[model samples]
Target: MFWVVAAASAVVLGVAATLAVVFWPKYPALAFQPLADPSRVAPAVPITSRFAAATVRGDRAYFASVSDDGTLGVVAADTGTGERLWGNPAAGDADDWQQLVALPDAVVAVSAEDDDRRRMVLLDPGSGKPLWDRVIGDDDTLLYAEDTVVLVDREEDRLLGLDVRGQGRVRWELKDPGSLSGSRTTTVLAATTPEDLAAPTSAKGAPFAEPLDDDRRIVQIGADRSARVIDARTGAVLVPPRQSVADPDDPVVAHDGTLVVAESDNARRIVAYDLAKLGEPRVLYTAPDDNTRFEHLTPCGTDRVCAVQTTSSDAKTAQVVAVDVAEGGRRWAWPLPDTNNLVPVGDSLLAAQNTTPAKVSLLGADGTVRWTRDGVAARLDGGNLLRFAKPLSTYTDDPSVAGEHLGDDAVELGPLSGVRPATCAWNTAVLACVADEDFVLRRFAG
Candidate 1:
C-alpha cells in the first residue's frame, strides 16, 4: 500500500508540473538569425588629449575637470550636429565634484569631499548654472528615467521619488526584509497567504522569506524554497513561485516586465517570468549540460541573450545565444572569442575583445560582422559612429557613407580632449561619475 501511494503521488506531482508549464506565459523556441558581412577601418580624424573618464548619452556630451589653476572646466558636444555646444570647466564648486547624470533638461552634479557631506546639484546644460540643490541624508540607489529620480533608502527601507529639479517626494516605504536567520524566516511579510509565497534558500540549508518589491509589487520566498510573486497594487497573488529542479541562483530583470531566475541543480536551465500575466514561468533556454556555465545574460531590446561557456579540454570560448521572451524560442547565436564585453547597440550586439592590444567587433543581429577596428575600444553611438578610445574613430554603419565619413573621420578629440557623452533630454539631463579628478554629464541639444 505504501509503494502504491508513493507512485500515485509522484504521478500527480508530474501532472501538476506539466500543467503549470502549459499555463505559464509562453515564448517561442530558439533559432539563429544570420548577420551581414563586416567592413574594417580606422579613424582619420586628428587626435587630441586623454580623459580621466567619459560616457555617451543620447546626442549631447559633457566633460568636467579641475584646471591647473584650481578651477573646474566643462566641455559639451552636440551629437546631432557634431558641434561643440558648451565647453566651460568653470562651473560648480572648484574644489571637489562628482556624480554626474545627463537628464532630459539639465545636468545633475553630486559633490562631497567626504561621504558625510553628500550634496546633489542640478545645472542648466546650456547656461551651466545651478537650478536646484539638495543634500540627501544618505548614499542611496538613484535611478534616473524621464522626469523622476528613484532613490531607494536601504537603511530605512524606503523609496523616494525626486524631481530632477531637486523637488523631493516620498513615493513609498516598507520594512526591511530582515536577516535570513531572523525569527520570520518562513513567515510571509506581505503576501496574500502562506501558499502564495515562495521560499528563499539559506546557507544553513534552511529556507527564509524575503520581502522584495515596491508599491506595485511584492515578492516572498517560503520555507520550502519556492519563490512567489504578489501584486501590491491590487493585493492579489499572481504567480505562485515553485521549487525548481535546480537551486535558486541569479535573478535578472529584463527590459520588458520579465524576471529571469535561473537554477543549476539538476541541469542548466533558466525560467523567465512574464509579469504582464500571472502564471508559471516559461523555460526560455537550457544549456547543453551541467558543465556549460553562464557568464552574463543581458537584455537586447525586447529580447535577451545569454553568454555561456561550453567547457572542454581545448581553448574554451563564449557564445551569445539569443532567447525570445514572449514567443518562447531561440533567435540566433554569435560565436565570440575573447569576448570581454557585450554592449547592446539598439537591436544588435557590440562585442568588445581585448586582445594583446584590444579591439572592437560590431556584429549584426544575423551574426554578420558589420565592422572591426584594431587597438581601439569602441561603443555604438546613434547608428553612426563607433566611439573608439584614444584618437576617437567615428565609423558609420552605412557602408557607402562609411568611407566618406572615415575620410572626414578624425577622433577630433584625444583622451583628455574631454568630450563626455550626454543624453539629450527636454528638461533635466544627468551626468554619471562625478569626482574631484573628472566630471561627466549629459546635455540636451535644444
Candidate 2:
C-alpha cells in the first residue's frame, strides 16, 4: 500500500509541473513588467462633449472636441508630462473642423461648409495659429504627402498638387478623374487624354520598362486595367498606358524605389517594378499552389517585403512570407494557424490567432518566432511597439485597459489605469490614446 501511494504522488507532481510550464506565461504580471508606476499615472483630460478624432506627433498629442454650445476646439498636450500645450476654441466652428491631419510643423484641418464649398486650413503645430486657408470645391478629395498636398476634384475631373509648406502654391494640376493612387508621400495620377479617351487602346502594348526618375513619377492604374507612370512634378505621361495582368492588391514602395505590387497573374504572385528603370516586371514569388492567395504586403525592413498569404477557402491555413525586394526571392515563411489578424510591428510580424485563450505570436523578418503570449488583444502601433489590451472587469463601469511596449522578452509599459476603447496612431512611435472613460489622453512609453 505504501509503494502504490508513492507512485501516485509522483504522477500528480509531474502533471503540475507540466501545467505550470504551459500556462504560467499567461499571467500579466509574469509575462510583462510594468515600465510606468501605476500610482504615477497622469491626470485625466476633460472632454465632456463629442470627440471626433485625435493625432499624436513628436512630443505632442492633438485632439478635436465639440462642446454643448456647438463650438469646436482643437487641443494640444505634451505626451510625456501630460501638460496642455495650446487650445483653440475659435480656430474653426463645429461645421468647419471635420478632418485633421498632422504635419511636421503644422496641422491641416478640413471643413465642409456645404455641398459646394470646402475649406483647408493649415495651422502652426505649436501655436494653433492659422498659417493659410484655401477654399476648394465640394467635389474635391484632399490627399497628403509629406511635402505636398493634392486635391482630386471628381466632378471637375481635375488633379491639383500643392506644396504643403508653401502658401498653398500649385505644384501641378492635371485633368484625370479615376486614375489617382499612391502613398501619402508620393502621388500618381493617370487618365487618357480626350483623344486617347475616344480610343482607349491607342496607347496599348506599351512596354512596362522605361528609364524614368522615380522621384518624379507615381505609378497609377487605369480603369481599363492598364499601368501608367505619371510625372510627379510636370504632370507628363512618363510611361503611357501599358497592357498588364497586374492587379493592385497592396502596393508598397521598396527602399530602392521599386513599386512592389501583390498581384495575381496565372497564379497569385508578387511583382516588382523599378519606377526608375520601368523594365520587365520581376516576378518575386509565385504562390506554391492554386489554393493560396496573397492578401496583403507590407515593407518588412529596408530591403524586404512581408506578405500574408491565405488559402482561398480556409482561414486556418495562413502563412507569412518574407521576400527580398532586391533579389525577388523568398527569405523565409512562417505558418500562422487560426490567425485572423496580421500587422507589421517594426521589422517583425504580429499574428493574432483566433483560438480560445487567444494567442499572439511575434515573428522576426527571418521567419523565426521571437515570442508568444496569451490572454490579450494586441495591435501594432504603426511602429516598433505592440499595444496590448485586457478587460479590466466584467462590470460596465470597469475600464478596458491597454499598454504599449517593444514586445521583447522583458518589456512592458502600461495597463494604464482608467482607459477604455483606446485608439493609437503610429508613424515612428505609437501616439498616446485618449481614454474613453475620462477622455484623458494617456501616453505610453518605455
Candidate 3:
C-alpha cells in the first residue's frame, strides 16, 4: 500500500507540472504597453490653425506654425516638460510652407514653394536657431537614414553624403555618374571614422519604422543605368549584391539590414542578401516555370518578408508566403487573391484587400490574422492602429478605437473614449495632436 500511494502521488505531480508548462501564456518581443486615460495637456506652441507639418524626434516636437497675422514659422516644444523649447515664425519661407524635420542634432526646414527652386534650411535643435540655408532644384532631394543625410545634388552633378551628427560636414562626395546608384555600408574611401555603432538604428520622425537597420547606403540609378550600391559613410563602392545586373528602373529594397530583390527584369528567382553577409545571397523562392510570377514583396511582421506569388494567369492561384530573414527560409503560406498591401507596424502587420471600402486585417508574426474588420478606415500611427468610426479626414472629428495592438489584445486605453487623434504625431511614449485648433500633448506611457 505504501508503494502504491507513493507512485500515485508522483504521477499526479508530473501531470500537474506538464499542464502548467503547456497552459502558460506566450508573449512576443517588445510587447505593447497600455496607454493611460486621456487628459487635456498644453501644447508647446499656440495653435491658431492646423499645422502644415509636424514631426517628433528624440525629445522635441517640431511643428509648422500659422498665426492670425499670416506669419509662418517653425515651433519646437519639449514633450516631457510641456514647455516651449523655442519658436521661429520668420524663418524659411515666409509666405509659403515650411516642412519641418527635427533630427537629433539639427532641425530641418524645407520650403514647399510653388516653383522649382526649393529652399533647404537647417536649424539648431535646441535653440531653434537658423544654422544655414541652401537652394536646390526641385528634382534634388535630401535623404537621411540612420543619422546620415545624402544630398543628391543633380545640379552639382554629385552625390554628397553629410553627417547629421555634425555641422553637415561632407564625409564623401562622388561626382562620377556611374557610382551614383545603388546602396552601401561604411568604409575608408569616404575617409570616415570607423563606423559608429552607437548611432540610432532607425530614422526618428516617421512612425513607419525603417526595419531598425544600419544599411547606411543610398540606392541610386547611375548614368549607365546600372545599380551601384555606394557606401554612404565612406566614398567606396561596395560589392554588388548580385552578380547579375538589377533593373535600373526597379528599386532596391532594404529590410532589417537585408536587401531583397529579383534580378533586373522578367526574373523568376527571388534573392535576399544579409548586408553583413554580402558575399552570400540566399535564394528564398524559385518558380518552376513561366506560369508562376511574383506579384509583390512586402515587409511582414518583425523579421519576416512576405512574398505574394501567382502560379498562373488565374487570379485564384495567387498566394502569400512568409520568409524568415535571419534564417533565410520559407515559414508560412496562405492563399489570398486580393492581396492589396501589407505594412508592418511594430510587431504586427496592417493589411488591406482590394474592395470598395478596403477590408482591413491585422496579421500576427506567423502570418495569422489576429483580427479583421470591414467598412472601417484604419490609420497606422506610432506602434498602434487608430480605428476611426469612419475613414479619417484631414482633421479627425470623431472618437477612435485607439491603443497598441498586442497580438490578440489591445492597450486597454479606456479614457480615450472621446478623443480625436487623427491629426497627431505619436512615438510610443507620447502623442502631440491638434485639438479644437489648439495644440495638446498626451502621454501614452507612465
RMSD for each of the candidates = 17.6, 15.0, 8.0
What is the per-residue lDDT of model 2 for residues 300-419, given as tens digits with 9 covering 90 to 100?
Answer: 655677867788837678777888878878999888877655555446666667777667777876788887766443432323344444422222232233343444343455455543
Q: Residues 164-253, candidate 3: write the lDDT tens digits.
A: 656677888877444344332111111111122111111111342222124555545444544456677675766453344345444345
Order the candidates by lDDT, highest first: 3, 2, 1
Please report, in order, the local distance difference test score of every candidate based on alpha carbons. 0.44, 0.55, 0.55
Per-residue lDDT of candidate 1, residues 81-200 (tens digit): 435566554344533555555555667666544555456666677776666766654455454434555554444444445655544443333332332333223222222211112111
Candidate 3 residue pairs in clash (backbone atoms < 3 Å): 181-220, 181-228, 182-220, 182-228, 183-229, 190-235, 247-264
In terms of TM-score, which candidate is stronger, 2 or 3? 3
Candidate 1: segments with Cα more than 4 A from true spot: 1-60, 67-98, 111-118, 134-139, 174-251, 262-267, 301-315, 368-372, 376-446
Model 2 lowest lDDT segment of ten? 199-208
Score candidate 3 by TM-score against the native: 0.71
Winner of 1 and 3 under lDDT: 3
